[model samples]
Target: MAGFLVSCQSDARNATRIPPTPSEKLKSNWQKDAIDALTNNIRRKIDLDNSYFKRARIYFENEQYDLAINDINDAIENKDNVGDYYLLRGQVNRELNNLDAALQDAQRAEALQQVSPELYILMADILQEKKRFREAQNYLNRSLQMAPYDGSAYYVKGMLQSRIGDTTASLGSFKQAIDLNPRLLRAYQQNIIINNRLGNLNNALYYNNLALKRYPKDAILHFERGQFYNALNKSDSALLSYNKAAALDPKLTEAYFQSGSIYLKWKMHDAALKAFEKVKNNQAEYPQINYLIGVTLERMGYDDRASEFYKMELEKSPENQLAYAGVVRLQRREMGQYSTPSAREPAQPSAPTRILDTNRVQIRTIQPRRSIDMGTDTTRKVIIR
Candidate 1:
């Protein structure tokens, strides 16, 4: 079995990751100083508008969209005349998936004479997300006309093209975005995703390398690299990348799940169980996690423990065929039927689970668990984030 913490070989095929430079670390210092200064100014009741906006930008950059929205709201409350405030708030709302509110905010910014290439691009993004492709294309064209060299405009154009099922055009636009601004992270990400989906693993790896050079500390990039490596059947490299991703961000439960999957493929049941347990502890309801743990335990001959997890998985995902199979096998075993069932046995079809019904008892809160949507195509799409 491969060691879980094993370092990747410095081989040409592996494309060794570069360490982040000292200069890259220094970039956060200015951001920290700016946030501190803004906080102090806000506390002193001085220039609340600018201070709140500045702090809000920091929050948005840090991916703290809720905190950013609160600050932007305060900024707008202090001075409603600022178009930039609405624009920033619209961006925050866009990230939060509040498409209608984001559109309203963008329109408000336009009414306030804040019409810029960025505003147009933002509108296009919101429209594309809403599946208003025609309107999104119009806005995107306007943004490009305003600032043809704008990397963000091209990024939005690429996203719009992708939504419209124009993967080739989207790839071209993404390349243009990268040419305009090599530091545009989203462009590289889109390129990598599209290339991988097109079965161009070499191109995907090349883009992944470029992105890692610029964003060596980004955990998502590492996780994506691991996926690419896994797709290429470079299991050792995939494992190394997954381990690096987990080390970079322990809360990234998907990395652990992927690592466990690789271990299970190798029949390293103990290692797989350890990795799956980490995912379960971090995110108990992670998709297929309980079912996978049950499989690992069953492989190790712990039928009782595996049966418990299989039932737990069934409770969470009624249509999980593998979990259902485990339940049947273990239940049969309990009845003294030691003969193993065929692995190729088809699972019985299950009734569709009702998510919500107005005629039923009015439950105010419902925590939905992720489940397989059997109706949808199981094949991966190029339109991933």
Candidate 2:
């Protein structure tokens, strides 16, 4: 809660895009159909424009924003008269963080007479990202008025409310989103975060459980459940949850980091080493991962390797006290001041959390550079550092 805020903006621009051949093999059935349609149309030289549009939508759904942009561009080039094509391109550009391009496309779409609630929502979300909050609010209000039961519009409203320091209203908006569309996973995630911000860990945990019931295979939710359990001092439960998350998505390096930290705490050095190694292998740049590895190595009496890791961490973060302490402890050990590193450990690192993006399921941890403004009153605007 201190570091991770669920922003109501897409991070799809930075997400990996699957290539066409791999996508055909690895993507969902709907994505496969779109690809097949595009492929067949290309081979037959028929209806290629609509085929590109359909494939672009599939790419968007897969979070392959770059490919989505390419396909949508091709579609627009083929048929610039269609309003929906401009709207789709605008959406793809928004996902790509091409805000200026997105705004231009939105304007084009509007001029083409595409005046739907979805288009309004897209324009509002784009404006929100641009920090034009008042304009965003106006567009969002219009979308809500046009489509009262649209869960996505409500979700965007929740994000706007949260941004402007109206947590109570934000929570209500998120709840309305959930009530309207139970499958809106991001709304559930936001509710869990707001509950945590309010110092209601139990409620946060309850929401996590609720989300898991709906999205049991969601690795990020499992990772969050682990964090909640660890906060509640349920270490055993935390480990189980973390392991489950890691199993679900081996790319989820934070799960390995958290599980390893717990293993280190339990003095299970070998297990700790393996978990940390998995994290190091998958994501060497993970926050303080080198420091954690150094501590685990020092605990296991591999002083030389431990010293190397400590130096590596210091290279990345010269101001890190824990890594600096690790180096000093090893130096002292070399001087025979201690037979082994002392029993007292450096202060454990704060638990790592994630920067949750809206409209996509990708999760990544941000360094604990600053704390959140967890004021008890919901009136305070939530600030992400």
Candidate 3:
């Protein structure tokens, strides 16, 4: 999705007239029947009041971004001058993947109420997505000035700072975010990555384990721990962690892929093929699994099987260069399998050492450009700049 955190601000003067705060508790337990009743009632005879704005949070809490947008649209139609309604609409539009509408709403909200802290954070997010880093920083600075202890603001700041190669600043911001809200998984992920990049392995492990203690069954966290251990050349530990991750969530293809790649690198071609086999029937379309299996088969001296695997990979991914290259190598192998180092080498052996790439088999893990905080639940959030 686009790079904006989706949170709303109250319109000017409407904050004082609030019912029970949605932040303190959801308006209801996300009851769809009540939502439909309110929606139908409003559509039948729209109330020209701020109640729609308050009800929009219920839709958001229910993960009904489209319904939320419709509610906010009605709220704006009734009171176009309200800045909070505009902010609400902006957030709703962002969730609906309508960036233009989101920006328009944000601009309108700013025009109505220029000093809203959440509005500044939202602007920072939009600017960051547009690659306007300097302007984004200015917005984050303004947001921080207004809400110094806001964890979301600090998380956005950390994400932006990391984008600009300010690792130290970004780390500081993530630390502050964690200090504000220890359960912020993304902030912990960023801390682990940045410290590992700086070769502070102990620090990385420390932070990741801290989060794991709190979120033991988080498959993503275990996968990330595997990444850290792999980075430090702890192959056995990494493989165990990856296996644990795969066992926790059977559809975690990256765990299998990485484990297979590790086995391939270690010359355990049988174990490697077994791991790659586990990756084949996963749900998230692990495109690299077939090619990796082909490589593993080739390494095991089964050229014909390897060729079949390579051909299958090509069928799955026509533009797979490594699969094509593997086919070429198989075609030209006049001598035996162990004739040369080049003959034994895979076209793209998953790092040939570590299994850390920006793209995982399904989702990008650990690297926190996207979800650096706010928890990876059903919240619509973003990393500004």
Candidate achieving the largest TM-score: 1
**lDDT-best of 1 and 2:** 1
> CA lDDT of 247 in candidate 1?
93
Tens-place lDDT per residue, model 1, 1-385, is 0221121122212321212223544757756756666677678876667668767888987778999999999988988877788999999998888999999999999999987888999999898878888998999999989999999898888998888699999999999999998888889999998999899999999999999998898899999999988988999999999989999999999999999999999988888999999999999878988999999988887888999999999999999899999999889888978744333344556669968767877758777988876796668676867
Poorest 10 consecutive residues of model 2 by lDDT?
Answer: 1-10
Q: Write the per-residue lDDT of candidate 2 for residues 1-385, one digit (tens) a residue.
A: 1111111011222221223433335457545754665566556655656667766877887668888898889877877877888898998887678999999999899998988998999899888878898999999999989998999898889999899899999999999998898877878999999998888999899888988988899899999999999989999999999999999999999999999999998999889989999999998888999998898888877889999999999999999999999999889879989765333455546569987778688668887788788669867788899
Q: Candidates 2 and 3: which is better by lDDT?
A: 2
Query: Candidate 1: misplaced stretches above 4 Å?
Result: 1-32, 58-67, 249-251, 282-288, 310-385
Cα TM-score of candidate 1: 0.70
TM-score order of candidates, top first: 1, 2, 3
The per-residue C-alpha lDDT of model 3 at residue 235 equals 95
Better of 1 and 2 by TM-score: 1
What is the C-alpha lDDT profile of model 3 across 1-385, one tens digit per residue? 0110011133326352333333444556324434554455456553533547756867765557877787777777777777788887777776566778788889998998656887888788777767888998998999989899988688888989899899989999999999997776778888988998898988999999998987888788899899989988999999999999998998888898899889889888888888889888774357677788888888777888889989988998999999999998888784544343344556544445666776655764586566556656657677799
Tell me how many clashing residue pairs each candidate has.
0, 1, 4
lDDT of each: 0.84, 0.83, 0.77
Candidate 3 contains a number of clashing pairs equal to 4
Give, for candidate 3, the lowest lDDT window spanning 10 residues.
1-10
